[model samples]
Target: MRRQDRRVHTYLLTLFFEVLISYIFNQLFYCETSKAALTSMPYQCQELILYGSVFADNLQDLERRLTGLCDPGSTEFHEHDLSFSLRTGTDPDVTIRLRRRFNVDSFTSHQWQFRYIGGPEPDQKCPVIVRKVIDSIAYSHLMMDFVKTLGLRMDYEYIAKGTVWTNGRMKVVISQIQRTEKAGHYDQSNLKRFADSYLVEISACLPDSAEYSATAKQLRDFADQLLPLVEMEKVDYWRK
Candidate 1:
């Protein structure tokens, strides 16, 4: 009788432990799956912009290099065209436009841009625009990298006006200009007076279905790539 009781007790203890282990494993698996789903949620980005500037002296040289890249005979050959338009009014605006259409392996013609601006001078202070319809989040990174590589080569100066991420409806914009001095040494007055001072604006439109967490992470990743090329403290706008 004593032997039978001991056997029964051992069996019950083993069953209890087995049940506990199964419960813990299930809980862990559930938590991990939930986390993965949250992280991997699809974020379709419709557009992206990585803005920067260079010294006025380098604008002509930069234009030449960019034109060469767009030239059909050049190794970086891309189908492109150039157009110009001027606004005559109280405030005259002159825009030199360079439109590049990209058609490469696995990339569609939809991926193109009209990078145009007035001048590189501080007094001109015109923002160079890179408007595009991005194919994917990863492609956005590559596009920015291509721009950054070219800009760096041309000794271009990159200023951050702001980094924007949107889905045509909801939007998230991280701007460093917001935190700068409002009325002191680094105030808008002082920044505007600086010859090299120019604003950089990067705007993008994502799919409405994109998860905020994933989209934010992608934006942060994009920002990370610019860290070495931009002021560390200024790029910290995303963190805030």
Candidate 2:
């Protein structure tokens, strides 16, 4: 009887330790998996943009003012923009813009950019137009093929020659728009001016936790300085 009792006690102790070890291992595994999932999750960003145009004749003046208001030494680029859309009846459901920069007169290497811009929600009280924006750097040469494989059709394309200026988090882009003679083909010689005015866009992209109102106020204050010269205001991109 004594031997049986001793054996029972030893067995109980062994079982308790085994159960505790298993529980500890399972908890460590769960924690690591949770951390991995959190790290892999994609972060969403938002863009606050104010749009306005400067007449061809007033572009020089606008540039001069931008030089004073923005940071010194602007960056210039010649880029081709291609818009791809996926439509499942009615209006297109998904639209993506791919911008490829050609190192023209600059020593920088060529690069491709992919941008997904969501339509701005109609908010009457919001100071600046806010839209969800996802930007990624694409390095693959087969990017166009990959996009086509996904059944997205090219909607429109254009050429943009612009200078970019930055003041802290805010960015100012003044670009001349041009259209290619043939769709999907960007031949420099065949490109023609799309409009007589330069497109002036002042924008800032922020994370989800950013204070959009404060950023919009800063943009408004800077835009106010360029008043009369170029009126930058919230634009309803979908409005006819």
Candidate 3:
């Protein structure tokens, strides 16, 4: 059998190399952000971020697509998550602010926590709170319903800071929206179309297939339900 000291060194080296390769490949083999959509979404926008990837394009079109899911005919695209700024004491939190198109009740503001923080339970999903804003519409824009998918994937093989750490680089789909004469927005040519996918991509890194299956379901459901709204039109959706 191999000596005990050599065995320990070999094991450590294997782990270190695994993690290093993961980071290098992630940086070098990233997706190209050139997807286009002819149809314009309501409100002028840009992708500041998508999911957890480095994508920071297609904000206007992405917002347009997101709001089209629930109340298709309304001018307000509500109940979605887009990158926005927040502040706790002095720390500026650049977060995806979940907004409701209109409020029904007098008090509907709610709470949310950053999911990327290295806490006790990084795998445990955070609780989505209620975001209520009063308006003619009855739906409360709390708890963003779905996520948009633009067919691009970010691949990685290792964790950034070992097992106790995570990453934030993303594959983004940048797009722009323009209003049409038909009372909505449509891409005249390459209006705006996108596909974004992101993950840590660790082999044998999970609880089980059952857990993985559940997570996959959630992601697919979100993508299927939200992306088509890219053709919507509402000047107010992109604004504060």
Candidate 4:
């Protein structure tokens, strides 16, 4: 009887450990997949990391720095999104600084931006066409490495459009930014702000009744539904 009891105890212990291992593996896998889903963008960078090793830390910061739609750079200018620039390595030796993430809160007023490498243009309003957008922005900055990196998606379009308010009326227009192809010998490029967006300013032209209110609602709805993945990083990893 003593021998049988010891045997059962050993078996139970082994089973418990096996179950615990299984649970741990499952949790790890779940966390990984969740992280990937949260990032929502491609994991590979010129095939450097195959969407593996994407973790809750550092990864979130990367996501915000890479794709965060809240344009914080433009104070004299307001911003809606960011672009990346790439530098390629061909010789036997080279080093490049890839954008990891930005301090969202710390960035406060000071702005940082990334641009496209080179390629096509983003389809109007189809923000998901990130390949083209990133490519365009990178090329504007003459970045080569960014062109090699694939699987980019821009799901949001936040523009601080210009608006004029006159006679209790408002008119909205697409905002324009001042930028040049000049590389930095001194400082970075400029990212202008859309202090005024069309929807926000357009209602000024309408009568001061609910008619303009509907247009305002339309703009707000468009902002919420039409644009996705604009700001997913709720926490800034660098701070943590």
Candidate 5:
């Protein structure tokens, strides 16, 4: 009887451990799957962009007007952008842009912006530009290496010094485009401006369910306010 009792106890112990191990493995697998599902869901984005320029002489006036029109506590930024292109040869090239800031006054100094912009919609009748845009914020710099490993080649790089402001969902940026005298060099002192005017762009990203008419009207009204100083209108980039 003693030997039989010992055997029963050993079997129970083995069964209990097996159950415990299975439970632990299932929990780990579930957690990992949930994380993957969340990350795989892409952000639904839409935007309206209008570009124009402010002459050096009228820049201060434009800035003052923007201050009064937009929300207070605007941010000034200096950024470097690298454009990478993935060529499949069979289809159109896919471009991804990576932007990082330098001499930033805000807490987002270490963040890298990974941006993917889809081609403009075929329907030109839409007042606002509708396209697929993914803007991912990554803290680690390993993203550059990961992109390169995907067979994307660096196409070009540039610098933008700008001030950003927000009014509700609308974001306004006035920047000066600059280029390095030597390729791949990002020094501020060595940068040369593309032109004497400041490039003004007003844009916003919205979710899939956003009403297009209301958004377009709002953009049009706000853009009208910046008139004479800068004319903001939809541009056909591929027309050239």
Candidate 6:
């Protein structure tokens, strides 16, 4: 009986030690993972805007495409939660936006817009805008890739404005305004706006984080994609 008691005690001690070791390892692993997540800076675009022009003739087709994409039942829904609104009167407009959440790491957003320019003039410009938001810097490239698919031209001027803070920087606001064209179907110099031509605007927030360098490079690349469409202008302001 004494020997059996000793054996049972030994077994109990072994099990206790094993459980204690497991608990310690689990705590260490959890701490390490939490620390890594906290230390690793997530790069993301807080906000982004892209401007372009669409013609009246193309309105129906554009609307149809947007509707199809926003439809939850559609296979091409692109895995985004969609919401939309339409306003009509003298100047009609439509807005379609998509959003997705990804904890603290990242989120995705896409917006499509069409607004009519109403005036007495024979020619008026109807503008369409595309805006997006990404919560992480890692998504910068992916977002730009999607932008390229829109066939947007950079025939515009871009400006960025922001302020710096100790804990975090202010959101970067980038605007790409369409320049006045001397001659074209969408010439603005003549004080005439055509539906076929569009103005472009892009805005984004630069997150201040450990990944700032990589994020900046990605942003530059994103802007470069539209360089071919932009007119000569001083963009030094953005660097500062």
Please tell me which predicted candidate would have the highest lDDT against the true structure.
2
lDDT for model 2 comes to: 0.71
Clashes of each: 0, 0, 39, 21, 0, 14
Give model 3's clash tally.
Answer: 39
Give the CA lDDT, 0 to 100, for residue 188 in model 5: 59
Order of models, best TM-score first: 2, 5, 1, 3, 6, 4
lDDT of 4 by residue, 30-88 (tens): 44355333221111111000001222334334334323333232122334343322212
Q: What is the C-alpha lDDT profile of model 2 across 95-134, one tens digit per residue?
A: 5778877543551432456666665746778888887665
Error of 4 at 108 (Å): 16
Please say which candidate is ahead in lDDT: 4 or 5.
5
RMSD from true fold, candidate 4: 22.1
Q: What TM-score quantifies how close candidate 3 is to the native fold?
A: 0.19
Q: What's each prediction's TM-score?
A: 0.21, 0.74, 0.19, 0.18, 0.73, 0.19
User: What is the per-residue lDDT of model 5 for residues 65-148, given as tens digits with 9 covering 90 to 100?
Assistant: 988999987998888888886543322245577888855235244356666665565656666566556565544425566666
Q: Candidate 6 residues 100-218, lDDT tens each?
A: 33122232332212111111112112111112222211112133343234332222221111111111221121121222244222222332222343332333354323223343344
| lDDT (Cα atoms) of all candidates against the true structure | 0.33, 0.71, 0.25, 0.27, 0.68, 0.29
Q: Over 4 Å off in model 2, which ranges?
A: 1-43, 88-92, 103-111
lDDT of 4 at 55: 29
Give each prediction's root-mean-square deviation over alpha carbons.
25.0, 17.2, 21.5, 22.1, 16.4, 25.4
| Sliding window of 10 residues with minimal summed lDDT for model 5 | 35-44
Candidate 3: tens digits of C-alpha lDDT, residues 1-240 = 447765565455434333322343223222321231111111111111112221324444544553443233322221212233322222222123222322223224432221111001222232111111111111213223321121112211111110111112112122222222332122244222232422111111222122343433333344444445332111122223
Ranking of candidates on lDDT, top first = 2, 5, 1, 6, 4, 3
- Predicted model with the maximum TM-score: 2
For model 1, the superposed segments whose C-alpha errors exceed 4 Å read 1-50, 53-77, 92-202, 206-221, 230-240
